[model samples]
Each structure stands twice: as C-alpha cells, then as structure tokens.
Target: MKRKLVIGDIHGGFKALIQVLDRAKVSVDDQLIFLGDYVDGWSQSSDIIQFLIELSEKQNCIFIKGNHDAWCEDWLSLGGTPSVWLSNGGQKTIESYDNYSDEELERHLEFFQRMKNYYVDDQNRLFIHAGYSSMHGPEKEVYSSNYRWDRTLWETAVSMDKKLSKNSELYPKRLLLFKEIFIGHTPTIELGSKEPLNKANIWNLDTGAAYTGALSIMDIDTKEFWQSDPLPALYPDENGRNVW
Candidate 1:
C-alpha cells in the first residue's frame, strides 16, 4: 500500500523542509500531507511554496492552512498587513518575494486561499494545522475559519492520559470523531520535547524547525518518522527564528 506521510510546519525554513523530505525518502506513491505554516519565519518563504507547488504535481499532496498562512493570505488579497503578523515573521515572507513577478506572487496567494483548514481521509484520519472544536466534523460552517486557529483541542488531548481510557466515551471529545489526528503549530519544542509527541491518539509533528529542533515527518500507518537537523544550524550566521 502507498504510505501516508504527514509533515509538520515548514515555517519558511526551506532548507529544513528539503532536509526532512530527503530523509523521509518521499516517493510518488506516497501521499504527503503538509500540516501547514509553509511561510513566515526564517526566510525563503516564497521558495518553499514554489517547491511545494512542484512537488504536489509529482506526488499526492494535501496542504492544510496554518494561522500564519491565513495572515499571509489576508495581506496578499487585501491591502493592510496586520502589525502583529509582521512582528511574528510576516516581514520575511514579504522579503522572500523581493525578486518575484506579480504573477508569481498572485499564484502563491491563490495557493493559500485554496488551502483547506482540515482534512479527513477515507480512513477518518484528521489532519489540521492547529485544533478542532470536535463538536462536528470538518464540514461544519462554524469551524470553517476556527479549525486552524483553535488550540484548545490539542490542549484537551494533552491533558488526557497518553494511553486513553478504554471506554468509548472517555476519549478527548475533540478527537473521538477521527481514527487519529495529526497537527502542527504547537511546536513540540515548546512542550519541552525535541521529538514528535503522541497523546490521546493525536500526534504533534512540529519539532520547531526554526529553532534548535528539527522539522519532523512521520508515516501515519507505520508511525515511522524522520527529521532534519536544527534549522538554525542549517543557516549558519543567520538568525533563523529571530525574524521578529
């Protein structure tokens, strides 16, 4: 069977993205599910999106939206970029397109606009950039914009035992609807873990590629994973996460 490979946030660390993919040995047969945050932070945000655009053409790919991606899309489609977004690394995304054509930039914005907030496969595996309310499936109109912005879903899962209760009703409410859930945005490094974390059947794949940890990718079925080196190390003399 073709493998299901889920990737964490890229955060504009294009070199780190390449490293993780190379380590994962991704092939055309595998389905690559990106957990979003493709831009912002570090630099080369445009380069990363272009690379992904080509990669999607070569392989099965699904791109979910992250909160940072929403900010980028809003600025691109409209005029005023939010001050908070710029302070949180949106400026680098702007800088990355210094040499790009208007058409190319438009394409990037369209990609962002078309991205999904959540993905539920035939297996009922849920992939999202952040959290979900769990009150309904991904189709609910109420969750259209909140799925990628909510953090409570993951927090609820983390609060439960890593080994959840056997009782059907005991699972974290947000995760009960899916066979398993994969998410990014909440970096594992911030949780004091340098590795992908599994709790309440939800996996947090982001290993803080923009900092001292690596970008992570995992096989959903086999649970096998790969990582790139600390992204800061990938770009010596440049402050990777200090785009702030």
Candidate 2:
C-alpha cells in the first residue's frame, strides 16, 4: 500500500530534506505531509520553498503553516524585517532570497500565504504546525493563531497519561478529538530527545534539522522512520539559526 508519510521541520535545510526523502524512497503515490518550518534556517529558505512547490505538482502533498513561516510571510508582505523575527532565524530566510527576482519572491510569498494552519483527515488525524492551546479542537476563533504558534498543546500531552484508554472521559479532549496529532514547531530536542517523540498520541516529528540533529520523516501508519545526516553536515558552510 502507498504509505502516509509525514516530514518534520525543515528549517531551510534543503539538502537534508532531499537526502531524507531519497533515503526513504518516497514515491509520488504516497501521501506526504510536511509539518512546516520549511524556511528560516541554514541558507536555502527560498530554495526549500521552490522545491516543495515543484514537488507538490509531482506528488500528493499537504503543507502546514509554522510560526517561522508566519513571520516570514508577514515580512515578505510588509517588506520590513522585524528584529524579533530576525533573531528567530528570519535573517537567514531573507538572505536566502538575496538575488531572487520579484516574480520568484512573489511565488514564495504566495506559497507561504496559502499554507494550511491545520488539517483534519478522514481518519480524524490532526496535522498542525505548532498546535493550539484549546482542548476544544480547532474550531474556536480565540485560540486559532495558536494553531501555528502554540506549544501548550504538546506540553499538555507530554504531561498526560498516554496509557489512558481513548474512550476514557479523563483523556485529554485535544487528543480524544483526533485519532492522532502530528506537529513540528517545538523540536524533539526541547523534550530532551534527538528523535521523533510520541506522547499522549501527539507526535512531535521535528528532530532539530535546523541545528542540533538531522531532518526526520516517518510513516504515519507503521511509525517507521528515516533521517538525513546532521543539518550542519548538509550545510557546513552556512551558519543557520542558533536561537529557538
């Protein structure tokens, strides 16, 4: 059967993304979901977005909007770089497109603007960038931005009891609402892990591809995984984002 594959934060590690996907031997027939943070690290933010745009035409692809992506989109649209965003790896993204033409940059901006904040599949699996603070699902407008900027969702999951039956009323409403949840904002490294982590049915696939570890890709069904070399090895010449 064609597999459902989910990719973690890429953070401008274009070469790493290519490597892991190649290693996984991902075919166009397979369903691919990129959890976001495709830019703002390493030195290929523009290249990464371009690659995914072309890749989408060749395969089944779903893109999520990440906090970094949001900031980048705002910068691209406003034409002003904010210090806060720059400190959080936005400078690397701006540098990546230093030579791009107006049309090319426009395409990337469009791609960023069109990214999904969250997606719910037929299986009720939720795919988001950073996740939200609400336990009532993604419907509430108050916490909507949290879909791409929140970490409390994962933190709550990490603190919950995964052993609890899904049907149990005590189960976290967030997890209870979906068959599974996949996110990428908070790197696994933050959880003291260098690989993908599963807690309370929430899967954090980001393996610190922007800094400390490799890019990761996992089969959503079998839970099998593949990774690229450490991102530094892939972009040895460039100093990617150093901050969280």
Candidate 3:
C-alpha cells in the first residue's frame, strides 16, 4: 500500500489548503497527516478547524499540534488581543466562529487538546510538529511547553553544525530510530533542497503561505510534492485593512 500524504504547516489558509488537497486527489482510503499550525497567520482558523474535524471523521487524519495553535489558546485564555493572530491573518478565523456557540468552542478546545505530539507509522515515517529533542528516546516524550515555544530547539536544529551533539540536552539521535522523519516548524528556502544541512530532515512544508510562499503537500511513499501559487496578496486586502 502507498504511504500516507503529509502536509506542512497550514496557518489557516483554508482556500489554498483545499486546492492543494484537491490537486493531490486524496481518497477516502488514503491517510492524511498534518504537521500542525492549523490556526493563526491566516484568516480561516475557525473554518480550518471545523473542516479538519469533519475530515478526521470521514478519513484517517493525523494531526500534530503546532506552535501557533498553542498561542491561540493562550491568547484566548488571557482575553488578549487576537491582534497577533489578526496581524498574522487570524481575523478571518475569528470571523468564522462568530456564530459558534459556547459548546462549539469547548469542542474545538477539546479537539486541540487531543491532537497528538507526534505520529509514527508502521513504515517508521515519523511525523512531529517541530523537531524532536536529541536527548529523549523514541517513546514519545512530552515537553512541558508547546513544541513551538522551544526556540532553542528550533535554532539548534537549523544551526551550522546541523547535528545536535549527542550529549547535548536536545539531541537528534533519539529520533534516528525512524527510517525517515517528516516535520514542520522552520521554513526552508525551497521545498526540497538536496543539501542535508540546508534541507532540514524535518521536511518543512510551511512554505510561508502567509508570506507569499506556496502551500505544499507531499506524498510520503513517492516523495512527490504539490504546491499552490503564493497567496501573500490575500492578507493585505483582508477586512480592507493592513491587519495582516
């Protein structure tokens, strides 16, 4: 059987996400894996969450929690300005949920809470929202903080050495157990560069959709990729303001 189709950070651009999935022609039997960041940096967080929930019900949808999703919940808890979300294209997401009842909000929170930290298939295709720490073993260790909040780990993964020292607190060897790993967090210069150092093993798929970059999806078995044109223009005119 073919491996599942994995997608990079969505950042709440539902229109582009739908287009990419349609282009991929994902079927009911095919597995779909999301690398996280389902909300924030786009206007469709609410719709995207609802759509993903529906998708999960109909098909095998594996979701990993992203940094932005963590921030959204935190912001909501503090009654903070979703402005950060809005500036990053979250206004539309808020608009989408304008009619949602309190119960629906609870359901959304529940779904977010239930999202996995990582996914490992039978083939050893590991999927993590952000890169894993080198120190921990392969038993799915949980971090006290959200994966996105760990800037040190992110910077270390993208450092000049590329390899986090085995002795370092956050080592990559722990994840060496997997034949191959797929992740999203740090954005790459291009979709699939061959340079191991330049090409993050994490398989960054975010593609900066909110910043005029393409939205991407990869077929795990074939390593084939599909992308939508950059949608950077979508944010400026949103709500007739420079909110994003």
TM-score for each of the candidates: 0.93, 0.95, 0.78
What are the clash counts of all predictions, listed in order?
0, 0, 7
Query: Quick one: best lDDT, which candidate?
Result: 2
Tens digit per residue, CA lDDT, model 3, 1-244: 5448988877777877888888988788888999888876666778888889889999888988877777666554454555665665556556767888989887787788888877788887777777655445335446645455443444544552656554575555544566666767666534343111123344556666655565788888777888865555555554322322
lDDT rank, highest first?
A: 2, 1, 3
Cα TM-score of candidate 1? 0.93
Q: Pairs clashing in candidate 3? A: 41-88, 42-89, 43-93, 134-170, 134-171, 134-172, 135-171
Q: Model 2 lDDT vs. the true structure?
A: 0.87
Q: Which of 1 and 3 is ahead in TM-score?
A: 1
lDDT of 1 by residue, 41-144 (tens): 88888899899888888988999999988988887888558899887888888888899898988998888888888898999898998886646655663756
lDDT of each: 0.84, 0.87, 0.67
Instruction: Give the range where candidate 1 is weakest over 10 consecutive residues by summed lDDT.
Output: 235-244
Off by over 4 Å in 2: 162-169
Q: Ten consecutive residues with minimal summed lDDT in candidate 3?
A: 191-200
